[model samples]
Target: MVRRLSIWAVGLVIAACAQAPAVPPQASAQETPIAEYGFGVLADLAGTRWRGEPGEADKEHGQPADYSEWDWDLGGSVLVNRHVLEDGSYGGVTYVQLSRKPGVLDYVYITSANFRTSGTMTLNADGSWTAEEDVKGLPHILKVRSTGRRHADGTMSGVSEFLGDDGEWTPGHSFTYSQTTAPLPDLVPSGSPPE
Candidate 1:
């Protein structure tokens, strides 16, 4: 029975691998030209949250935890910047800052983390764009990909992925945002201003 089960598992794994997406060929390093663009940052203030199975082995062994009851109140902002390449494709870096609000959960306190993600953003003539980022960190790495339409009002809507620590890339999160009309404040210089 055990031998049969192992065969079944192996068959399932092969079937799943056949369903993965094919990677596109990269542009030649020497042929690709680098282009850059400056973009203003915007915040999506509707409030974000994340919930998942607890990491504790004891908790999982004792009883099944209700994941629906576990969640954290968090907020995040995305700084979008883009550059065009000689291959006619575009790429850019998006700096994302995420913070969890205090006293939002009963059992856990979420700490603040920032991710500086750099990826390729391809703009299609059809008013649609796709952005992909490969994020590397200690213990694990993630590949996040997003596809959205650029509205006439300068807003964007799309779905995202939160590839987990196992190195397997999969679609996991979704989000939407509109451009803000308020003017952004100027940045302070490194040196202190004259008092």
Candidate 2:
């Protein structure tokens, strides 16, 4: 009698469970967002904007300061960077994508000055990144190498060197950038687009 009663109770519970309404599982509120591009090496750069004034060397040469905006686009598949100089002298857009090889990124830069560069960038072990690029439209500059690192104080610093015709790597530009809320100004604003 005891066994029969236990089985009957189990059957009732099973029937009740079977008759209950089904509920889809809900996502956890505490769940973290997955970093896109798998490696997430450049995650910190997304949704950030920066401003860098020309260095003393550049100031002495009348180079204008520049502003940069970085963001993830194309459903987080590509990292886009747009920059413009203060005096409207130059501006460019850069697209960064994951290369065929893991842990490497390929970038293409096109500027208003009709210069273009294609490069591969790698993240260093010390939390810095380095880029090696081939420059087009500049006869004197054959290649460009650059490195950037973010500081703890929320600023960034980078140095670029140009490979000249003489095969010497000369200093190109050095920048110390601070985070900014400003947008990149138009390089050549002519008005609204034709409808």
Candidate 3:
């Protein structure tokens, strides 16, 4: 009986694998360029909040506790990132703005994290972005850098690293952002009042 059950389990596993598709559903639709690149790309990104899921490295760091949500608000010409970790114990907010500069081919991003660390980056042709900046008040001069990319899954993902005065980049933690659900609109009776 045990041998027979094992054979059945093997068959089930094979069937499941065969049923899986090559690409995830909606990949082609979402990843395709919806509009010309540049500041225009921010249109679909604006008025929306993307939430991040902590990776294994982040979890191992004893962070990203519940009640700590990573949300990036891309509205107006600026991007506001709010994070609450350990129920508001230790978390910092960041503000990032993207624009054009003289002789710059890509949109330059200026970021201020908790008013401490300041950085700049640009969107790359590969649909990825990177930033580099310094933290004002630390034990030592600290330079931080991060790289992230957006995917058709409607998520922006990245990792961050700390550059100590020694100029060594400590392995950083992973971060990502996914769209937050929009609220339903309120209804009002119109045309003719219901009886």
Candidate 4:
């Protein structure tokens, strides 16, 4: 499966390049997102800190990753997620997003300490993002599918669902992750300019 995904990703890059327009002498920060091996739009998540607050969970049926801290690195394209239940031990995922058609639809590819998975996330008409994960692994007891919607207060709420072998889904614990940093303007160099 990984092999097939790799080949498909390569093909996507080639197709996007063939369809991409010429870059002007200078491109602004608002320039069209570029998909170089699927790392373009994912760049937006950089330099952000997410603090995930736990909600309610079923101790018997639901298995939620209790995240107390999540820090996304701008330089490394990595997210270090600290688990609340298991202190000192944590998991990290390197986020990668590839545009299948440059500006049409992009897919998310995440690589973590143990596994790599791919999926899609679409922005809803209501200004929220609904993300779907390709694989959610915990094995037999329950096969979970990840789905989440972004909230307006820079908070993302997500829950796991158990996809029945017969194609049904049961929702699990829902949690919210909020951005820790308030949006601040860039620092003025020194004797720059008077606003």
Best lDDT among the predictions, by candidate number? 2
Candidate 3 backbone collisions, by pair: 51-178, 52-176, 68-84
Q: Which 10-residue span in candidate 4 carries the lowest summed lDDT? A: 2-11
The 10-residue segment with the lowest total lDDT in model 3: 1-10
lDDT of 4 by residue, 1-195 (tens): 111112112212211222222334465424433332343333344444454544554333332323333335555544332222212122333233334544334444432223333544433223233344454332221233444555445566655554445666665455565555433222222221111
Score candidate 2 by TM-score against the native.
Answer: 0.74
lDDT of 3 by residue, 1-195 (tens): 110111111111111111112333454523432223233333344344333456676556444421112223444554443333322333344454544441111222121111255554544434554456666544433665666666565555666666667877676556554455533122222222111
TM-scores for the candidates? 0.34, 0.74, 0.56, 0.48
Residue-level lDDT for 141 in candidate 1:
41
Against the reference, the lDDT scores of all candidates come to: 0.27, 0.56, 0.38, 0.36
Ranking by TM-score: 2, 3, 4, 1
Over all chains combined, what TM-score does candidate 3 have?
A: 0.56
Alpha-carbon runs more than 4 Å astray in model 3: 1-38, 65-77, 98-115, 182-195
Clash pairs of candidate 1?
33-86
Better of 3 and 4 by TM-score: 3
Whole-model alpha-carbon lDDT for candidate 3: 0.38
lDDT-wise, the better of 1 and 3 is: 3
For model 2, residues 104-162, the per-residue Cα lDDT tens digits are 67778776655577877755444565678787775677787777666667666666777
lDDT of 2 at 81: 75
Ranking according to lDDT, highest score first: 2, 3, 4, 1
